[model samples]
Target: MKNILVLCTGNSCRSQMAHGYLNTFSQGKAKIYSAGIETHGLNPGAVSIMKEDHIDISNHTSNHVDEYENIDFDYIITVCDHANENCPYIPSKNAVRLHHNFFDPSKVVGSDSEIHNAFLKARNEIRSYFQAFVNEKL
Candidate 1:
């Protein structure tokens, strides 16, 4: 099975969503993990948004990239520009690196409906991207 790592500035939102979608899409064909340049705990918005799509990430923890240094990953995907630009080097001999700057829904400051929409938008985009990733690469 392929081991995949999704990276983000904070493992709170976007990467968490991607991890959930990829896990669903891969269907035990691949192992999915997510971490951040810095841990910010799981975002409640992310958990709630994913629950809408029937993916639970509430039990997921915000991990630092350094925690998985010993595991050999097949793919390293950065879901935000900050992580792509600033992520620490992981010693993987054959990991393929990919990047996509997903919008940060946690940064949205507005009404409840607007905030929910933002999270929904990010979740959908992540779902679409990882669906393609699994179809083509997993």
Candidate 2:
């Protein structure tokens, strides 16, 4: 099975959403992990959005990348520009790296519907991207 790591500035939003979608898409074909340079805890907005799509990420933790140094990952994906720019060197020698700056819905300030739509947009984009990743890579 492929071991995948998704990284971000905070393992709170985009990275978390990507992790959830990748896990659901992989369907046990891959071991998906997500972390950040710093843990800001899981974003409730992210969780709520994933839950709407039936992928529960509420149980996922906000972890620091240092905690995963021991594992040999097959892929390391940075889900935001901040993470892609600041990602530390992980010793997973064979890991393929990928990056996509998914929009942060949590940063949107608007009405409830607009906020929900922002999360939905991010969630859909994440779902689409990971679905392609699994199809082509996993």
Candidate 3:
């Protein structure tokens, strides 16, 4: 099985969403994990959006990249530009680093419905990108 790690700044939104979709779509072919430069608990908005897709990520906790220091991953994908820039060096000769930036929906300051919609858009986009990447690249 391929061990894949998705990374971002807060691990609250994009990375978390990516982790869920990848794991769900990949079935058991990929062991997926997500983390950040700094740990922030999973966003409730993210959980809600994921639940809409019938994926429960509410139990998933935010993690720091340091937690996976002992484990080697086949792929380390940065899901945002901030994470790509701030990512710490992992001592793995064979690890493939890839950058696939996604817009941060958490930055959207609006009404409750608008905020939720932003997350939904982000979730859909992430799913699309993940599908393309898996089918065409991986």
Candidate 4:
């Protein structure tokens, strides 16, 4: 199976959402992993929002990129600008790197509806992007 890594500033929201969508889109044809420059812990909003879309990421953990230093990844994807800009070197000889800055729902400070909308928007964008990634690249 092809191995993919989704990286972000934190292992909390955008990366986690992308991980979920990528896993679904790849349909067992790929192995998916996600990590952060710093572990911010899995965001609750991410879990809830994913659940709304019938994906479960509540069991996912916030991980540091250093934890996967030994695995040779096929593709390394950064889901946010911060992670893309500041990402540490990963020693994957042939890994194809990709970057897309998904909106951070956790940063949307407002009423409940606004927060929910933010998460939903990010989730939808992630789904669309990864589906295309799987179709084109995986």
Candidate 4 residue pairs in backbone clash: none
Error of 4 at 101 (Å): 0.7
Kindly indicate the candidate among 1 and 4 with the higher TM-score. Answer: 1
Query: Which whole-number lDDT from 0 to 100 does residue 37 have in model 3?
Result: 96
The numbered model that scores best in TM-score is: 1
Give the distance in Å from residue 52's predicted Cα in candidate 2 to where it truly belongs. 0.8
Which structure is stronger by lDDT: 3 or 4? 4
lDDT of 4 by residue, 30-114 (tens): 9999999999999999999999989999999999999999999999999999999999999999999999999899999999999
By descending lDDT, how would the candidates be arranged?
A: 1, 4, 2, 3
Clashing pairs in 3: none
Model 1, residue 54: distance off in Å is 0.5
The lDDT, on a scale of 0 to 1, for candidate 1 is 0.95
Give the alpha carbon lDDT tens digit for every residue of 23-91 in model 2: 888989999899999999989889898888888889999999999999999999999899899999999
Model 3 TM-score (2 dp):
0.95
For model 1, how does the per-residue alpha-carbon lDDT over 1-138 read when each residue is reduced to its tens digit? 999999999899999999999989999999889999999999999999999999999999999999999989999999999999999999988999999999999999999999999999999999999999999997
Higher-scoring candidate on lDDT, 2 or 4 = 4
For model 2 the local lDDT of residue 88 reads 92
Q: Which candidate is the best by lDDT?
A: 1
Q: Best to worst by TM-score, what's the order?
A: 1, 4, 2, 3
